[model samples]
Target: MNGYGSRGSTPGQGRGFRPRGGVGRRPYPQDAQEAQAARPRKLSCPPELRDAFVEARDFLAGLIAALGLPARLGFGGVDPARDGRQITIEVRSLADAPDRPDERGPDGRQEPGDLAILIGKHGATLDALSALTNAFMHRNNSRDLFFSVDVEGYRARRVATLRSIAQRCATRVLREGIALELEPMPPSERRIIHLSLAANADLQTESIGVGSQRRIVIMPRDSAPPVEPLEDFE
Candidate 1:
């Protein structure tokens, strides 16, 4: 006999075996269907802002191409902050293009040392790019629009690291009953440090020093008993 014994006969058991019901199809759960139907959809952006973001993305794309960089621009999003007075356009580098001196490697992996060239010491290059892009927008009469260019999510990761450092230093200050001074950071980074410690009542934050030398000082609050004044007697 062949693999099939006869018409409508089970493959292995000959005439005695019968096929089970619903063998080819699994039933979908009603609750899961309901849940899927109830799930919320993503909200769409306002038309004017979306158009402006598209224009900004195209502008950056052309600029990157002109610079001969082996990278492509990806739109992150447009975020409005400072009570909607300021708009920030976030752009990411795709970096799928061929290896460049500071981009990729022959093995198709990112080179740390090369990437440091673009990021610069303490993200100076990245900040410069952001400022330059914002200036471009201003020159185009975009007005109040800013741009932040990040390669491979570097800025996001750095912000997280800064916040963690702030928390750890705050904890140490609370325990040691002494103040700690952090290394000099940019105004934006210093703001991150200050905001990270803002909610802790046992510690306080202060930024001091000249422009480039500015840093954050995490200090312990003095909660000790007050000394009584030695009055009278003369």
Candidate 2:
């Protein structure tokens, strides 16, 4: 997920738009009632693991309180199985967020004021929050954790849009015989592009850039020889 660099070009004019996991499979989780029936009172986790999630939830709650933002959150218990070597945390803002665009400053480029502050330039704030949550979990649990914090449904909608853009770019790259350089995107979004194009034999892809300026470059697959055996890998 961290393959791509941070933010890229504005997604608005990319010509096309609108669009997780290992083993290519993730099992369905049991309902709370059914799970309780199957494994009653098995919710106990190591204190460290338990606190990792708890502290994360609490930290966000405290932040909301400190900012005087009205939000109601229900802390569903954490699943130890799902809480692995890396703790994964998810936060959703109960209140609907307003759409505020960037404003132009004296400089030519528009300065992202509130939106940038909220998302943190290049999503750095969100990333830092994630890291802090992971650190707290790892320090107590002695295991690393991966956390994702989403304001409203931003992350979900972003993923959907990225998938569509990746597909459209892939198609264009195949047809034009010219490489397409996408606007910088988060590492997770880049992963979506990679996965979307993984099966296409007609095209080859690679990401280029540094930090938040990184973008994915897609081009036609030359009639090249096999790099490695498919069976040797997944």
Candidate 3:
């Protein structure tokens, strides 16, 4: 006859609508479960946000030490809380220049070639450094954080280089009737080409292949685009 009595039985209660005490029982409705199920999962940042670029800087740190390079260096993380989701963690090293050196560039730039060993061999070494840093950050972060790592501003410079290449490729596609295929590049690099040529009406861009083989292709515009052709390209 307690609270459960009189009418029909309530959920998890006897016909009298009575409450029960047990090892794993709750009196309230399963509100938490219902709320959790109703909520949607969201990513903190887009795949290309600065927070996610970790593949470059970490490798440089290890490579410099192993190859016996200059030791003056500085590394840190930057979480500006950009927007609600994105966070940028910048790790840098100045092998030639002391981090807090009294003498600084007239323009306030870090000393040059401080981490030359890190940017070795046509950026092969630099690329490795970026990859290693990303791997490390991913392991240490509480949640799956995405960030880009730069060694001596390599990523920034690379972005400019990629944009130039994208423009040239787009031009070639417009001039020639054939499609232009670029060398394989990272996903971020491919995105750069896509964005750079997004406004091109005469030519369109698309990415193809998987993993290491993935690359961007620029093709002439067509009325009915081909299955994998970019935008209006056929």
CA lDDT scores, all candidates in order: 0.50, 0.46, 0.45
Q: Relative to the unseen true structure, what is the Cα RMSD of model 2?
A: 14.5
Clashes of 2: 8
Cα deviation at 146, candidate 3, in Å, is 4.4
| Candidate 1, poorest ten consecutive residues by summed lDDT | 5-14
Sort by TM-score, top down from the best = 1, 2, 3
State the local distance difference test value for candidate 3.
0.45
User: Which is the better candidate, 2 or 3, if ranked by lDDT?
Assistant: 2
Give the alpha carbon lDDT tens digit for every residue of 105-162 in model 3. Answer: 3333344544544554324554565566556666866444434333444444455555
Tell me the alpha-carbon RMSD of every candidate: 23.4, 14.5, 26.5
lDDT of 1: 0.50
Expressed as tens digits, the lDDT of each residue in 51-140 for candidate 2 is: 455566676666656655544332223435564544333333322112222222222222322222334433556667666656655575
Clashes found in each candidate (C-alpha, N, C closer than 3 A): 0, 8, 21
Model 1, span 13-118: residue lDDT tens: 0011111231343322222222232221223435556555555556665665665554444444445554443433333234333334345433333434223444
What is the Cα-based lDDT of residue 37 in candidate 3?
Answer: 22
Ranking by lDDT: 1, 2, 3
Q: TM-scores, in order shown? A: 0.61, 0.56, 0.51
Question: Candidate 2 at 111: error in angstroms?
Answer: 23
Model 3: lowest-lDDT 10 consecutive positions: 1-10
